[model samples]
Target: MRLPPTFYPALHDRVRIALDRAGLDALLLDDPLDVAYLTGFAHFPNERPVAAWVPRDGEVLLLVPDLEREYALDQRAAARLVVYPEFPGERGPFTVLADAVAGAVRRVGHAPSTSTGRVAALAAAFPGVEPVTSDLVGRLRLRKTPEEITLHTEAARIADAMLAEGARLVAAATGPDDLPTETELAGHVTRFGTAMMYAEHDDVVVVPMLTGGLVYGGANSAQPHRLPTADRLRRGEPFMLSLGCAVGGRFVESERTFLLGEPTAEQRRYYQVVREAQETGTEALRPGVRCVDANRTCLDVIRRAGLARFLRHRQGHGIGLGFHEPPWVADGDETVLEPGMVLSSEPGLYVPGHAGYRISDTVLVTAAGPRRLTGYPRDLDDIVIGA
Candidate 1:
């Protein structure tokens, strides 16, 4: 799922338009992800600073340490390579970067994530130029391009396979003593998903570092953010598995709560309510719908069950290059859902000392309607293990 070389050129054209509208003569970017997004150059981000300089009417420049010069050129990045000695050298990288853009830009722009020291350095570079905050790149990333959607779809497939494998592992336990501990289950599931990703994709440079899962069983499942522990899963209890993977920098998640053994009326009731709420919230995501309204739709379902008191979080949030981004599906957010926007649909209920039930999927808002990118079953029969 490697983006074609032409992708950056088109992205550059879009940035130029954005720069014109922002009245910025140039954009000074030091964040690794932002640099990678615009220049098609992904590197090991560390304390050693790497930056991308894009001027309104000229070629892009990349400031890097001498060590990364060959690597940057090897990637065939669509930018002019500008190398410095190293970080904190006799002359710092920022000093060198300032020299590169000294006379070219008058009103320089930076992202909100930029450090205050970095902004100050840019201001000192040239007395005539002023540095100001700008969200030109962040705004451009809210909507997914067709190619990005393809990568997210592929990531979703891997997430689905991992979840199915996890269910099979739980089903293999013939008795309570045969069950695996939470840490063991989480580790094995993550390794299996990472292996599957490597076997399927030949375009990856590094290992799939973002493929992993968290397993919480029994009482621990009652906490929405609980980490995997050494507790063994017991029959007649609930276990929650949250799994995700990334492909081409795009991410997708698939999560489910499973009942280890046959029915307890309360367990069945909680699972059904959560599943219904998830479906309702996912369907409510349509073009022109406000983010708050989508969240309210899920809350309405939980309220009907008289379980609103157990609600611990919002319905979902945006997903893409980053795991969580803007246009959050929560209260006080008035962002309107539009075509090409992708979000996570998770409606959950957590009751301390009892159990928790939740189901999550990555969904895409399309012109026709909402499309579920992760195609794992949500039915109660399909999720119950070793029943």
Candidate 2:
């Protein structure tokens, strides 16, 4: 699921534009994703720092440990290699890193993720060079390229399949006693998704493209970020599953809340409200629409149902290399939605002692309209198990 080779050249061209606009001679990126975004060097991230140095008018430089030289070359990363002996052999990696920037580059821009200590050290190492902190790469990543969208579409398909498998597992059970525990259910769905990704795409990278999620049953579902437990599913309670997958560093999310059996009237009403909210939010995604406005439109549905107090979070946020990126669909953010921006449509309702209801799908803002990348069914009947 690697991006087309041509994608890197175009991406660097855009980065060069950003650098010139910022009045920077070059940019230093240390965040793992930012580094991978610019250079396609997807090594396992750890305490050992990996950085990408992109000069406005020259080739990109990937600074890594000596141990990773072969790995970076094997990946055919799109940059010149700048290898340091080890983390702290005789001199620290940062000091060795100064060799790349010293004398040759001045007025260098560092990513926002660069630690204050590292920034101070880099500054001290290169007294003549000015280190400016910028969001040059982060801003560029907000919009997906056509090639990125293709990978996102594939990832979304795998996510939808995971949800389908999870629903099947629930449906196979005749009653609460027959239901799998929360841990078992999540494990099964994730394992199935991982297997499917490998089987479906020869280009998928195992180290970087792992797919997984967790399930929350009954009252546990009320919290948006709870871990799956050993508890079994309860009849007449809500079950929530949120699954995400990545292909070639592109990502998407698909989620749903299901009723274990016949739902009570209150449960059905809550479910309907949230489902309507998600659909409304998805539809509101379009060119020139403000993110905050889309968020407000989604919240209106819950407010109309007199469940405004139950709202737990914003409509959603942008999705790409990072699971949660900027251009947030929340009150404070006013970023205008543009064509090629990919976001999640997740408007949820949480009642502390009862349950939480949410349906999230990856949506692409396009000239025609908002297109859903994850094609899983969201209707009440489609999600109700053993009904």
Candidate 3:
């Protein structure tokens, strides 16, 4: 026995159980994250329709492009690797897939990430079999396994290192035209973390680091998700640094609001409010708690500070193989919190045209309660760049 990696053997068992419980004969996994979750078949999904037909009672069959055959075999993630030509003559990928899907099962289930064309092809093959969309796998994935948590913890460690580097870069800026422009700083953070990410690949299956989209100072920092610009660090404004990366297919996020010169009373107030809201939300990440309740817990802090109108988005979302996964932290989501579920506790205040202050961290709901994975400090003194 090779001793399966990334918990694939255990994950497959869960999928099979889900299939039986839901009366599904087979699960046709196509989402890159889902595929990686089930088979550890890591490959970037593109125009090609790569899929894994995991039957309830048999070995997993991975359908891959001829180009990916070698790696798929080397990894030995799938029980049986099925290779499709780059360009099939008359028998295309669809025809081949139909035969695989039609081999045993009748009730087929597809993930949300599945393509319309792939589903259509399946329908064409079995006209009476209507492939239903099941969140069974998604729900199963919501709770992270211990091995998955190990990967997430490593991802958080990488995020913390990169965030520390970003804060240092901001604090070390001597003048406006320093070595790192805002965009360059973003690249530096990503480049540094990516190098480490690949270096850690010896012990794990590392994915590309998803460098948190860095936004520089002043008005740019005020807009959440703003693209980095050539703008230099402003003296009186704050540089909101957000950083994230995936280690071994697990993702983690870290963020901080940094100020160059001393922050004015108003700037300090904004930063304090955002920080308080973040704490309030993080405190609620316990098993049995509702997802929306956690968001409100964070929101209430801002509401009391009378910055409620300034809040632009939900508190956060689940973080794992995907940056944003299920169980969104919002007012409408009623999903209950469970141990092993990982989420981001990020509450922000964005004052359009002036500045945006955001603090985010990956939080894991455990039996003992919430545990903050990203270790970057959120204190004003810790993040303040300039003296």
Per-model TM values vs. the true structure:
0.95, 0.97, 0.94
Candidate 2 TM-score over all chains jointly:
0.97
lDDT per residue as tens, model 1, 332-365? 9899999999999988989889888889999999
lDDT of 3 by residue, 1-387 (tens): 122464676778888988999999888878888877777777877877677778788888788888988978776665577777875436667567666653556788998867787788777766677798887889988998888788788888988898888877776767866736688888888887877766755645645445555757788877788889987767788887788887667788888888778778998899988988898899998998999898888899999999888888999999978998988999999999999999999899989888889999999999999999997988887777676
Clashing pairs in 1: none
Q: Where does the lowest 10-residue lDDT sum fall in candidate 2?
A: 200-209
Top-scoring candidate (TM-score): 2
Per-model C-alpha RMSD: 1.8, 1.5, 2.3
Alpha-carbon shift of residue 150 in model 2 (angstroms): 0.2
* Regions more than 4 Å wrong, model 2: 101-103, 207-209
lDDT computed for candidate 1: 0.86
- Write one digit per residue (lDDT tens) for candidate 2, span 1-387: 998889898999999998998899988888988988988888788777788988889788888998999988887898889898877577767677677653476798998889997788777766678999999888888888999999899999999999999989889987658898999999999899899988877866544647887699889999999999999988889999899998888889999999988889999999999999998889999998999999999899999999999988999999998788987998889999998999999999999999999899999999998999998999999889887
What's the CA error at residue 253 for candidate 3, in Å?
0.7
Candidate number with greatest lDDT:
2
Q: What is the alpha-carbon lDDT for the whole of candidate 3?
A: 0.81
